[model samples]
Each structure stands twice: as structure tokens, then as C-alpha cells.
Target: MTLGRTSTVPLADLVRRPELGLVVLAGADRLDRPIRWAHVSELRDPVPYLLGGELLLTAGVNFPEDVDGYVRGLVAAGVQALGFGVTPVYDEVPASLVDACVRQGLPLVALPATTPFLAVSQAVGVALAAAEHAELRWLSEAQAALTRAALRPNPLPTLVTALADLSDWWCALLDDAVVAKAGIEEIDPVVVHMARRLRAVSGRRSGSTEVGSWHVVGYPVAAARVLVVGAARPFSVADRAVIAVALALLALADRSDGRSVTKMLLGDDPHEGYRVVRGQRKARGDAEIDLGTGLVDADGDRMRAIVTTVPDVVAAQTAGWLLAVSSPVGVGDLPSADREAARMLERAVAAGRPVTVDDGVSGLVDPEAAARFAATVLAPLATRPELVETLRIWLACNGNWDRTAAELGVHRNSVRHRIGVVARELGVDLADTQRRMELWFALRWSD
Candidate 1:
């Protein structure tokens, strides 16, 4: 029932049609209001079925005794204008109905005896069809303009500007350290708060919140990146469709840029495989020299390099640089490799040596595989958080009852009871070293 802006026909235009023989009886200044549809209802109270922007045609067959209340109800239901058809029951609009409509500022149109209600309905339908066709053309042009903007050298700013113009709202792209904005110099603090909340919940793709007179909507485009738009009114169907297109374009632009960097840093053939090398250095120069590439990215005090292979000798000989090498992985798996490399780098810094994914005791570096395995093994205690925590603590303490009890602030007997329960639930022998090792690996990998 929601009509697009371009699909709406003004009441004044409908009344101007000569064949309808329509006469404006009241609220002449309100004739420009948009009419979405025409409905002929004889029911005394049909407000529940109306969705606004309606030109309700009634012949006064079941006219309500409380004329003022009836006109007020129509106005409240968002009926654009009331059309009184001249039927045998009421040859003309009643004086009471006219007075009520005039008081309520609801437009009233009188239909002649010669003009069938069907004629007015057909007129409105034809206007709507024409408007819809025009709207489609405009949308197509706007999409083309946005697409062109996305292909520019620096597309982020261009995209923001184009989206702002298209939506008639302020648009911003928020990253961790920088914000790109258009149609506004400074972002409202309320919008910034909403963006932060949206980022905290990663699984949410899009959301809307109200700030004063503005309605803010945010959509996640990448990890730690969001596109936000603020407007005075709620977004219509056309606006949302355009936003979806913009999101897709933005994602493509980001990936395209990232792929170029990946090729330049690693190699032209990414699928051939690569290893992410990380080093702790105050400056990025030393790590870049050791890694044989100036394409190293500095994250705070750590430098990361994506290369075809690991330089073990350089890693071992470097003085202040602690190094870690990820297991060989294709370009598509680089995100996983980057995460594993970060963990390995932490362990290397702790042990004062280079570490690799294989250095771990378990072959569960692949996060998805590890999660599935853990879920399968721990299915019995999945719904029992306290029991899961007790088992994990007991495992961490090397299955020592006294240590686990001290860590958990519980009695030794309680630890013993929980361990017994876990053993029974898992159907495993905690006394066997091999079974204990397997469980320990599952716990570590799952974390």
C-alpha cells in the first residue's frame, strides 16, 4: 500500500478532468495532496482497510449520523479527498457533510450524476501508471550516475557524494581511523553513537535509528567498515533499492582495491600460495628488508608481510624483530592465515623464536574445522555453561582437583564431582593420558 513518491497523483489533477464533472466543495487549498488509490466503500466505518492517500468514493447510502465524526475519521485515516457520488439516495452532497469536511480541512469533491465512479477510478489508475513509468526512467538514470561515480579513481568520496544527492540525505563511510563524509561537514554525535552500536554487533547487516528530526540508517560493507545515511524522513522502497545497489558497488570497489594490493605485495599469481610473516619492530624498515619487500603493512608496533615463502634464517638472526610464519595458504584463505600468523607471532614473542601453524600440537588452525569438531565433541555440555567452564578450568590446571578448585573458588570435592560428571557426559576416560590430551587439544583449538 506504500506508494512511491513519483507514483502519487495530486488530488487537484484528478479534479481537473472534465469528464468526471467533479466540483471542489471544501478545503480547496488542500487539493495538491497526493492520492495513491481510489476506493468505493459503502461501509459506515472502513478506516481499518485504508492505508492512506486514498480518494474514498461514498454515495451516502450508509451515511453516519455523526457527520463531523465521520469526516474526522476519514482525515485521520489519511484519505486525501472524499468523493461524494450523486446517486438516487443523495442527489447532492449534504450540508452537514460539507461543513464537517470544511472544519476538518479534508478536501471534498462532488461527482455528477453523469460521471460513474468507474470513470474517476480509471483516471487515477492511468495517472499512476504514467507516474510509475516516469519514476522507472529516473531511477535508471540515477543508478547509471552512481555506477559512473563508483568507477572513478577515488570512488569512496565520489560514491558518498552521489549517494547523498540521490537520497537527499547526508552519507558517510566510517572506517576504524578515518571517516569519509558528503553533504555534511561534521557528523552528528547521535549518528556516530548509532554507528558504533551497529559495529559492535557484526552479524547485523543493516539497522535504523532516530536522532531528533533525522532518521539514520547504517549498513555494513566490510569488516569494521559501515555506510551510514541520515535523512529527515524514512527511506522509501526506491531509496532502499538504491542503497542496496550502492552497498554492492562499494563492496566491489573495496575488493578490487584489496586485490590490487594483494597482487603487488605478494605476487601476480595469488593462488600459487603465500605465507604471512609478522615481526615486532619499532620501525617497519628492518622487517621490510628482511622480508625482501617494501610492501609490509605496519600495525602499531608490529609489521606484517605476505610473501611466497618464509625466511627462517632472517627471522632467526634478526635482533629486535620477533617473527612468525603462517602455514602456506592460497590467496582466498589469506584472512585465516593472517589470524593464525598473529597468534603465531604472539607465541614467537613469548618463546623468542620463529613459530608456524604446524608448531602447535593440534592440526586445528582452520577455524571453521576446529569449531565444527569442538561443537561435535562438546555437544553434551553445549547448554550447560557452568559445567563447560568447570571442565575447561580443570583441563587448564592439568586435571588437578585442588588447583581447579582454588581457581574456581570452589571446594575440592565440587571440582571432583564436576570432573566426574563431565567424564560421564562425554563418555571418555579422563584417567587415560591420550584421552586427556585429545580433550585438551579440543579445548585449546576451540578457544
Candidate 2:
């Protein structure tokens, strides 16, 4: 197990500090071990007072008879290194202590008489705080980079690049094979097999192993999709956190990331009929949502997808979304189905609930009476042909200013202005769901 946090300075850090004048005399190769703290202990047996990972400093005030036994005890107590101070008790580090440390593989450092043990302790504390601060700053910046990558046009590839850039490690997204990768040109066969093995096993979300000096790890993010990353060194806690964030974002945007609607529709069989769904977020902006395993394309408040099964309207509403689902149609009819979903979304938004295109309420009512009532309610919009057409198109688009504008080949500001005019002319607050529902019905019956 590791001794301390990544923020804790290693034994080597103390020796490199010019002010400390500390020199490594034994176990030089093991200086990378982290020092949790530094303390002066002149007792012959300081192991009993240790809680592990300490750089125990002493001036040989009370030398142990058995130096080998003392070094072994410190090792058992998890003392990372021993620092000898040249003072009244000794002009230099004892040859016996140095030999015992080398034989036991315990790190040893010699402190000059000019440098007090207290200064070494203070320096260790200051270095630890600085390292911790640097790690936190790095974590925050790395998370921000991932967020920005997620918003890109091709999020999956961009995310892979971001992970590679931040970690300086090879990152790849794997399905049956590598879907996207960075930091390496070709993937090792062993890495691919490990990813597949992880997918085959049940309840195995993540696993890691060492291969030929490379530390490789894999995590299952979605159905049949795995994110694999490799580096020369093992991953730290912060590194894992950044990868988790990327995996979660990738999972939510899986089928649709850099993929097209056609691929989603033909996922299983080309002959299979599919439904087009549109959803409007109750509260807009970024939030995680499950849109099913289909070709999903989400742009802020509006989301579109081609799904095999009909969506659960109640579930969508419960999840804070107003959903609209179209009737199942073949691949050739997807275009028409999307328009149907768009129109359904308009009603769902106005009614402040979920709506299905197949829910035809017009036939239930008397057509003549409904038409008469519709004409009376819509008479104000009918006098101007543009307003009548605009109202119809606008209602078919769920009051989305941008979409309404795009359909009418007008600017979004123009669409907003026209909607304001209709609201004022009818003397009703468009913000009211009941008013919008009434207007939707009037437009529906008029058509």
C-alpha cells in the first residue's frame, strides 16, 4: 500500500532543498517514498512512537547497541527514511547506522550541523501544503477541461484528446475495438483483450493491471463500450476522478456522440420501424439525463432521438422533461416522423405535459362546433395571413424561438417580436400554460 497522499513530499524532495543541506547516504533508489512528516527522536527505539511514513531525525544522543535491530524496527513501523543530524553527539553520521540502513533498504539522509532539525520539520510541512495546493488546482483545471470538451461538436474524440493532454497518458474508448484514441498510434492487443474481458464479466465496472512497464486500466461506461487508459506510472486518486467524470459524460452521450440518426435507426435491423422523440427540458442548461439507447442529439433545452421502443411519458415528466413521441415509422419515413414529433412537442410544451402524436382529440369532439369555436378564438390571427401561418408553424415547434425562426427563414429576434405581437393582439399572457393550450386547440381546429 502507498504511504501517503500525492501531495506529500518524497524523501528526495528534502535532500534537493538547498537550504536543508541534506544528503542521501543510503537507499538512494528508494528516495521516491513519500515522507508523511518529520520528527526528531533521540530515543534508541523510536518505532513505538511512530505512526508510519515519518522521516525520523536524531542527533545520536542515545545510540542503540544493535543498529541493525533499530533499522528493522523502523522499517516495520513504516518509517519512510532516517535523518541523522551531526551535532554534539556525533560530528558525522555513524558508519554502523549507515550500514544497517543500507542492508535493510531503509532510506538514510545526513543533515549538516549548520541545519537544525527544526528547520527540516518546518520545510517538510511547507512543502506538503504547497504540493497539496498544486494537486487541488490541477484537479479543478482538469475537470474544467473535460467539461469544455464535452460541449464540443465531436465530444468523444475531443474528450479522449483532453484526457491524454491532462494525464500525458494514452487514452482510448473501446467497443469491440478502439472507437477513439489519443497519445498512441496503435493499441496493444493485451489492452484490447482486457477491455473485452471486463465487458464479458458481470458487475465488473473497472479493473487495472501492469503490462510491460505500462499501467493499463479499463472502465465500462455504457453497453458494450469501455474506456481504456494507459500510462508509464499508476493512476493517482485525482487521475481516477477526472477519468470518472469523462466516463459519465460519455455514457450519457454515447449513441449520439459523433454519430448520425441513420446509424441509430439501423442499429438492429434496417426493416425495423422506429419512433422519433423530442424532449424539452423543464429547467434548461446542463444536466445528466437518460434518453435511451438510440441515436440521440441534444442541443441545450431541445433533444431529439430515434428510438426502437416508445418512451415513457410519465417517467420523462417525472425526470423533469416534457416529452413528445411520434408513431413508429420505417427508415424512409423518419423525416416525416421527426416533423410529427416536432408538432407533438409543440403541444406538449404548451400543455405543460407529455404528448404523443397519435393522441388525436379532434375526432372525439363535434367537428362543426369545434370549428365554430376555433374560428371565433382564432379570428384575430386570421386577419393577417402571415400571423396565421406563423402561429401555426410556431405552435408546431413548441414555442422554440430558434426553431420557429429557422422554419420561417426569419431571424430569432423577428420570431420573438411576432410571438409578442400575437400575445398582445389576443390579450393573453403566453407564459400561461392554459392560454397556450387554448391557442393550440384553436390552431388545431382551424387547420
Candidate 3:
């Protein structure tokens, strides 16, 4: 088997070996093409077995009468050169075959009577093996360099630069948009478009497509994160191995970076106080501003910020984000704030605006207690999702029958009936404002 394109030996190198006793009779200028292997075949039609870049040898034992057709077939099969042995068959290279090879631009090699085809094959084999060994060594060196870079203070930029250097191509780490790039001033629009397309299609770990003269390959590093490479040609097996190493390193760096951010956010540093925000759109600001404001995840869907003063709900609403804000708390209480922010996020999503929590629900005591109370109170309607949803909407509308019906896309009488069933099943009076208040808290906390 032949090593891939990256580790191929040129046909001229093989021809230059004096021990092979091979002479190029045609296509001298085309000797630079890569030679994958030296294949021996005496059959009249050996094109079916060829995989391109082979130096085909023959003794003329089964040489076809149509010399032009034979040469054409070999060219079509991507045979790098034709070696005619002059011992057991025609004693000399035929003029017809030489003319045909010259016409087809296929290099013709004359194997002398004393030189065996096996010698040339062995030389080519040894050369290919050496090339493959060198390629592997290069890949190993590149992997080591990338690993070292990954351990540096800023690993992402280092990894990107190392990958581009190793591959001799531009590389980019696409976190939502272009987060880190190297070997190129600006990312091509086609690469950006392909990155977005790959992100949208889940389970597709890797893909390749053409962009202008460049070949673009993309690998999904994480959810909403992609690694893109642009090169003049397709990547070789060795190139792909290096890319896989870089991807793994990048993933490790991301996990470690996230943990570091989390630790800093939750540390007991006296100046540490932050809020976590989740939204559907990417945050807009300067790079330094973004870094100072918060750590935005690669997906651009979430951020955690260190701020002395919390942002107002009105600012979030005006920006068209379903924002959730947490009350100022100590590092130890940040986890509780996260949960409170999550609940507020849910409420904001439902209300199509922003929600802020100064201190979580006062009447519910705690989430566990509220859950237990909801189980006891709403167990009767547990199996009826429609009734539970109606109850929730009805409570959210403050017992307004007509508004609840409008929201549920049902008649006011249907809302009234579901509410009546809910009250009777739990044996509670719906008209009692105190009971309504308790039910509302239960619904909100349980959800």
C-alpha cells in the first residue's frame, strides 16, 4: 500500500536510482508526480486493479496489438509510469509503445535485460516506508507541541496557532461566531456559513465542502462550538490525526476554563459578586467589555457577570431578552441565586419579558417544602395535564375566567368547569382569597 499524498515519493526520485537500471523514454517533464507504489502486471488489461499513482511493470508477454489503447487505459487508471522489461519477451522496448506513451504524456521506463522488475519494486517500497515513518514522526512532534501549548495560560489561542502551523492552513475556533482565529486576518464568509450550517445539524461530527479555491473542513467540538480548517487541498490521514488531537485538547481546555470561571465566581474573594444571565441572542460589546462584564459560553446563550450593581428589569426587557436577575448574596449562596435566577427565567419566558428576584418567594418557605405541599394539594389533578395547565393559567390570570379562557383558547364555561373540578377534587373553596394565594404559590413553586 502507498502512503497518502503527504508522504509520497516522487517518480523522479525512483528513476534517479542507478541500481534500478530504469531509463525514462517519454514524459520527462511529468516525472515530478508522486509515485504511490510499483505494481507488476503482464495482463493485457490491468486498469481494473489500479488505484492511481502506480508504476506498472510488464514483460510484454500479454502485450495487446492495439498499443495506443493499452497506453490510454494505463493513463486513465492513473498509473504513474509504464516500465517495460526487455528480457523474457520482446528483448527491446517497442517503437509503437514508445510513440503511444509519448502521445499520452505517460512516462515510459525501459527496464534493461539484466535488471529485474523486483529490484525496482523493492526500492520504491523502501522509499514509501521511509516516507511513512517520517510522516508519523512529524505528527508525533506536532501533537507534543500542541499539548504543551494547551497547558499554557491562554490555551485556545495557542492551540489555534499551533494547529495552523502544523497543517499549513488557516484554523479557527467557532464559538457561536468567530471566537479564536489564526493564520488568516479575517474568516471567509463561506467558512462562517458552513460553520453555522454544521452547528444546526446535530450528530454530524465532521464535514467537508469547497469554498472558492480553498477546501474547508469543519468538526463539531461541542454543542454550538465548531473547529474549522481551510486549506488548498484535502487533509491527509496524518493531517486528520493532528486535527483530532487538537480537538481533544480544545475540549479539555474548555472544560478546564469553565471550571476556573465557576470557581472564581463562587470564590470567597471579598470583591466577588456576580449574576448569571441566559438569553437567545449574542451579547454586544467590545471584547474587553465582554470579558469584564461576564464569561459568555461558546453558545452565546448564557453568561455570568461580575457587577457591583444589578441591571434593571426594564433594561433587559428593552433589549428583547428574557432576563433573570439574582439578589446580592455571598459566594456560599450563589448556588441558591442560580436556582432563583432559573425560576425567574422560567417566569420571564412565560411572561415574554424579564423577571427579577430580590429574595426568592417568602411564603413558600423553601423549594422542597413547596414541592411537598404541591404534591398534597394538586395530586387529585395529577393525571389531567389539561386541568393542571388550566389551573395554572387561571391562577396566573388572578381568577379572571374570561382571560384564562382566552389564554387557553377555550370557552369561559370550560375554564369555570375545570376550576370547579379542581376545587371539588381537592375539597377547597376557590372563592377564598387566602386559598387562592396558597394555590398560586404551590403552582409557581412546583413548576
How close is every model to the real structure, measured as TM-score?
Answer: 0.54, 0.54, 0.55
Across 1-447, the per-residue lDDT of candidate 1 in tens digits comes to 223244788898888888788999998998888898899998888898899989999898888898988888888998989999877789788999999999999999999889888999999999898878767776786688778667554667778788888756889998663457888788777777777777888685687888788888999886577899887678877777788888888877777766755664567664567788877763345222346443467566677877776676354436557777888887778889888888777656544566666566443244456567777888898887788899889988888889999999999999888888899999999989998887776776556
* Of candidates 3 and 2, the better by lDDT: 2
**How many clashes would you count in candidate 1?**
0
Q: Candidate 3: where is the Cα deviation over 4 Å?
A: 1-7, 88-92, 261-447
Q: After superposition, how far is residue 223 of candidate 2 from its true place, in Å?
A: 3.2
Candidate 1 wrong stretches, greater than 4 Å = 1-7, 16-21, 48-51, 87-91, 176-178, 261-447
RMSD, one per candidate, in order: 20.0, 13.3, 17.7
lDDT for each candidate structure? 0.78, 0.81, 0.77
Q: Which candidate should be chosen as best, given lDDT against the real structure?
A: 2
Regions of candidate 2 where Cα sits further than 4 Å from its true position:
1-5, 28-30, 202-204, 256-447
Candidate 3: deviation at residue 390, Å?
96
Worst 10 residues of 1 by lDDT: 286-295
Candidate 2, residue 9: CA error in Å?
A: 1.0
Ranking by TM-score: 3, 2, 1
Model 2 CA lDDT for position 226: 86
lDDT of 3 by residue, 1-447 (tens): 232237778888888988887888898998887888889998999999999989999999878999999999999989989899997778789999999999999999899988888898898889988998978778778888887677555688879998888756899999677778998888877788888888888785687888788888999886478899888777887788888999999988877787766665665566766665544332453111122232443234444443335666565555544466767677677677677676666555544555555535632144456568878888888899898899889988989999999999999999999999998887999899999888887776566
